[model samples]
Target chain A: MQIMVNGTTHEVDVEEDMPLLWVLRDELGITGPKYGCGIAQCGACTVHVDGVAVRSCQLAAGDVDGEVTTIEGLGTPDALHAVQEAWIEHQVAQCGYCQSGQIMAAASFLETNPEPTDDDIDRAMSANLCRCGTYPRIREAVRSAATKLMEA
Target chain B: MKAKTLAVAALIAATATTWAAGETATTTAETEAPSVSVADGLEAWSRIYEVASHPRCSNCHVGESGIPMWSGPSYGKTRPHGMNIAAGESRIGAEFVTCATCHTRSTQGNTVAHAAPRVDMDWQLAPAQADWFGRTSQEICSQLRDPERNGGRTAQDIAEHLDHDLILHWAWDPGGGREPAPYSLQEHIADVMAWGMAGMPCPNG
Candidate 1:
């Protein structure tokens, strides 16, 4: 089982049906990504499969032949990636727990729609639940990050 | 700062009162008494257990990261649920974009913002870990006291949240399709208020 997460390749053993989320959280001890809802209905378990934000909870372990990036790999806490930095500047976290999944979703959404409209954000982020009512803030942070990314 | 504090406090107090009242409404004696008569945490913990386990709460108390989550079915042939809606990350339905698309907020006594059927406060599930799916009341009591696991909410915050949050109260008066928590919102509050006053004990076994 050769898989690269954040540029590190690792061989692991696990059942095929086990979702990638468990592979990250249990097999690899990557706890940054949370399990809000497992059925892929909630974006809390979102991670990158080849740079696209797909609910890792929905993807089985066998689905892991592609490149993966968890929140930990998104960037360092001290020196964040553009999206993370943008999240900080825009104050995206409330519980701060859902930010990882939200960030993953936003980053992936922006990749395809660099200049996303409000509807784009609403559609892209509609899959994630903040529980804290942080939707408005998330929308703003995403736009801010997109601008920052475009500038670079 | 005051407005924010008040808002949070009001949200906390209002929800808590509504939840508590819903749980223990039969106690006219309690209601006739002053509002200062608070409930204990253990008692509240039990009711919270019932509510958290309810579909309203349990549906969202998602398990061990990456595990599959649950969602209600759409309208039509769906027996358990009538709506064809799906709760994406927004918890507000992916394709449908209307606060009223689901349920009106104020008309019903529930937690607003696409609120629940009706209640004294808003409605939703507890934190994932606090979920009571086949779990015991003692287990829930213990979970509420923990910070790291409870989304960093402090014991005081938990007490306040349970006590005042209108959503917490909504569990009792959940419009339909489900049974209300075991106790009335008032009784639930008495238990929670007592729990906080009792040093928020976790029923040390």
Candidate 2:
């Protein structure tokens, strides 16, 4: 099957039932999305498919009919996305194991809700767990990113 | 399939014998054996309660919020579903991230632990009216009989739903160390059919 990831299409041979997480990490070698709970319980494997944040671990590679975007594709090193910039401004990473998923989920949330209240942020980001309990900073960063997006 | 057919045949025979004995005796028997009476329907309901209240079934059959639960034997702590996932009014998360975005419509077995289990149907929470979480067995039984609360489904439709819905079948075969609902799927279906055949009586009724 051919899947477009990070604006590039890659043809890969694998089982249709193989999770998109494995295809990204083991096959195509895009390892931004981590493996936390293989189930959808944890949002550690979050990614964007056609601009919607979803658990990559639960998504099948063959079923992906949308353009895929991982944390790596969010921004270039020189020009970070607004969420990434705010993440750095807030110093959001502690263990950093779940930061990529958090960033991805936030980016998608902000796309629809560029100016979100605390409750909106809570409802949208609640699925992404940060064991370090960086939720306060996550909220701050989302607010900061939202401001930047509004300005842009 | 063959076993189910035989079970249905046996049930018919049992119903016939009860009818031959007359309605009065069957209704007042007070015995545990299957019979053609309101008591039998209530008894079947008790069994249905056991399965419907199990975490595998009740977790997704949430209240008006449309937020599925995460409580069960498998989850050490009973809490809201992880990832703050909400089904919204659609009960499928179509307003935001769709359930099918992660849950596939393929019946492929999910053998690995902690992985998203797959079913051939679109994964979603039960409708609001069918919400069973935190409800008593009597309440659930009453709700099931009400056409307004039960999706306007007839008594026979309830049996067909239990017998045919793959999402419901997933309750019996949920992988990933998750405990399944009480009783085998076949047994649950039989109980549901028997309850419907007995006029879908509730304990309070």
Highest DockQ: which candidate?
A: 2
Q: What is the Å distance of residue A75 in model 2 from its true position?
A: 4.3
Residue-level lDDT tens digits of model 1 in A1-152: 76688889878888765667898899899888898766545668777777766667656576454789989998887878788887887777877878888888788778867887887677667767788888888888888888988998
Deviation (Å) of A101 in candidate 2 = 1.1
Q: How accurate locally is residue B21 in candidate 2, as Cα lDDT from 0 to 100? A: 10
- Evaluating just chain A, the predictions reach TM-scores of 0.94, 0.98
**After superposition, candidate 1 runs with Cα above 4 Å error:** B1-205
Model 1 superposed RMSD (Cα): 19.8
Best by lDDT: 2
Reported per model, the fraction of native interface contacts reproduced equals 0.00, 0.49
Error of 1 at B122 (Å): 38
Candidates' C-alpha lDDT: 0.57, 0.78
